[model samples]
Target chain A: MSDSVLRWTRPLAALVVIFGLWQLAGRVWTFPGYLFTPGEIARAWFASLDPETGSAVLATTLRAVAGFLIATAVALPVATVAALVRPVERILEPYIGFFFALPKISLLPLLVVWLGYSDSARITMIAVSAFFPIFVYMFAGVRGINPGYLKVASNVGASRRERFLHVVLPAVAPMAMAGVRIGVAISLIVTFAAEVVGQSPNGLGRLIQDGFSALDYDQMYAGIVMFALIGLGLDMLLRLMTRRSPGLWGEGVPA
Target chain B: MTSPSHVMSTTTVQPTALRVEEVTRTFRRKGRNVQALAPVSLSIPSGQFLTIVGPSGCGKSTLLQIMGGFDTPSTGTVTTPAGPVTGPSRDIGMVFQRATLFPWWTVEKNVAWALRCGGTGRREALQRSRELLDLVGLGGFETAYPNELSGGMQQRAALARTLSLEPSVLLMDEPFGALDAQTRELMQEELIRIRQAAGTTIVFVTHDIREAVFLGDRIVALSGSPGSIALDLAPDLPRPHTHEVMRTQEFLDAYETVWACIRDQASAREPGRSERAAEQDDQGESA
Candidate 1:
């Protein structure tokens, strides 16, 4: 195998070894009282994914996705407008900084009181948490385009729209990707936090909360593991997407 | 006084290529005005290769920058076919001291981008870029990135990118100055060949006397501090001037004359211009 493949193989082997140990610690060792194996977690995961009955797993994924999409939709336009206009950017800058400084978890009670203890409060919390990082990343990307690139556009007699489409937007795409990755992380974190605080009807966070309440340690660990794995998957998908966009991340970064 | 309208008429009547009239540059550094170039005037006819040679900090690069419309002179004006050089014009292509290729682009893409900017379709641009890359002896390396290429190759790609525009006036600021001696010579010959083929009126800036003499139809020698044209040496050497021309007695004579002029200016600029003048006065009286 090539050197790159060899490097990957070593990491893959280490991962397998770690999982094998985890399985041994849980199953083969026969540690009783809520200590379940990977097989048990898998079985539970499959059992909780029935579409007709609306599984706990499905509800969890849906809630997170819904919150993420809402946050991104609102944040993207706000951040873009803030980046473009100087006065607006100044007006929003202090507010954004203050909000980012304030912990979203601390505002859970206020969010519940205003939006109620339903999915609305949970989603609002998730959006609030996810929104800032995306806003920051998007703004930085837009502002970071070199003056020289704009000069190039002007020299070439490009119209304002042409310059934006060709140079400005393309230059900011990498930074936008960076923002998206950060947003994804925030989305997952806030999703879990929301479930814990608001106790949303369906979600991994709810499952974990219920498991912990009942002292079902294995179920809580399984939910935690599932959350981490999904987040990792999301990050990988974003990385691949960024790599594919030639106009943005193609420079210096290896395929 | 040449009427601006008359100048504009003659230039507009037919592409005048490039013209700088009494173009002086001044800088307000630390609340004091330093005149880099005194009022200097020159006209470059189309298809003529004009090289400006001067000592370090002689504002040769400054003059080139003014001509390329990269900087504005404090006083006087520059007139080109594409109106007053208020900003960088597509009709004028400029290559700086360093190759500033977008690191994200492949060598082919970098060259192709110039054409893409010029409104050519991507397919056609890619084809033209490949031919241009081949012209610069970067053939078969289209897929290679800028980082993969050597310094000389990178400069050549930069040259290719500038030429891809097919601009009427090509402004190069020491394009080959950063290379090894052998590479510089080879690149200079390649540039001459390319300029001849493209019929580009080039304003090449250099500190090397031989390189200037080898390349330019007319060499504009600039002086320091308040940079002004000290000499405009027109080499009437026979056509198809090659590297061998540098070995000729005529070439050597011209080099020596240009060197003497540059050396005097360098010394004058070293110890304040006033002190140099005083020293000159003492030597004159003693003689």
Candidate 2:
């Protein structure tokens, strides 16, 4: 076999084995109505490539992206401030701890009540869920920098702005990227959960919820497969972006 | 006692490049006061290579830090030609035992960044970085990240970065200590070449007695616990030092003298004569 084909053989074989067993169980065993056969799920997935399903995918993607952007936009500066100032960290510690500890899904009802059943409530919930992880990672990254680097910067007569731009930003970038990766997954998850629980106008989550209600197990499974693929695709995209700057990934790539 | 007028007259008679006037340092750790360095005064002339050697925990680093203006002296002053050293200045550059390069930056950028911090223009900083890299024999490795370089190469790049600021004083704390013996020797030779070319005053701190004699025009050995300078000797070795010079009798004698001074300091801390003899036996086994 060719190198590319050889590389993919293990994953492909694993997929075939798992799906074969799942299909056999679905055919022979008595299971719940929600349980779907692999063939049925594949057919439904192909069928879901219509304009209606496309719109649902777009809606969910937009909500997830928006939540991710807003979460990072607010979290970056706030985390930076908290890391630099001990008093600010003290002030925010209890609230961040409380929110981070609470189950974010439980807040969906309260968000809907406060912000109404509009897209705003769903985005807010996703943003809230995604914010803590990024903030915590960035805070730790900034705090954990080697004091030697700062000493060298000062010795070189670096100004406050220069120190932040050259030393602090690059030093903390890897950890912040790790946080962003986590935030990407959390944003997607919170968006989907909010859609199902809040019954939003259009999304993959709503499609799955409606399919389940109408006893269309195949369509629900198709939506689930799409969710997994989207999540994986976004994660891979993040990894590729970081690979371009190998230093942020702690690798010594040749120029 | 001599009046302030008499001190001023003495200071005026001979101008010093760097002066440490009774500089002392004390730290409070876990509610206990620890005196790291006692009142120490030293005056170094321009373009002199001075090395401070001591045993572990003798606060050689504390004294170096105080001299570099990275730490404040408890009740004394360090003054340069410009004025009192209150904070870190561009005139003095420091190199640590570890390379401490910003891993994210390529070799050229790391050097260039130091120049940039000193308000050099971007293009000029980069141009200067290329020249310094070449000077340090790292010209082709300009685009390589720090981790790609060998340990010796990393320290060479760090030296280039420190030199980029055009500092008149270079303070190094065991800059080649982490390298293997062969690499450390090569780095020491490379340093002598660079020092001659730059003509910067150097105050180096190391625990290695041989390294102290090899590098310093004058060696100052410090005693342990409330560290104070115990012995100050000038080796009087010829300039443009080479590997063959290490085999010379003068070099061996100088090394022996420094070793004896350090041993004496260590043995003085021992309680009894028998214990001191046992310590000497242990040293012999180690050698």
DockQ of each: 0.21, 0.46
Give the alpha carbon lDDT tens digit for every residue of A162-222 in model 2: 8999888988888888899999999999989999887798999999999878988777888
lDDT of 2 by residue, B1-287 (tens): 11122111212433466889998787765697768788899998666789999876677888888888888888899988888999988888899778889998899999999999888999999999999999988989999989989989999999999998777678998898889999998889999998877777789999999899999988999886678889899876877797678888889999998899889988887545465544443232111
Model 1 C-alpha lDDT per residue in residues A118-225, reported as the tens digit of each score: 888887787788888888988887777665555556555566786777677767777777777788888888888888888687778888888899997756776777
Predicted structure with the largest TM-score when compared to the true one = 2
lDDT of 1 at A97: 87
lDDT, candidates in the order shown = 0.77, 0.85
Off by over 4 Å in 2: A1-39, A252-255, B1-15, B268-287
Residue pairs in candidate 2 whose N, alpha carbon or C atoms collide under 3 angstroms: none
Error of 1 at A70 (Å): 4.6
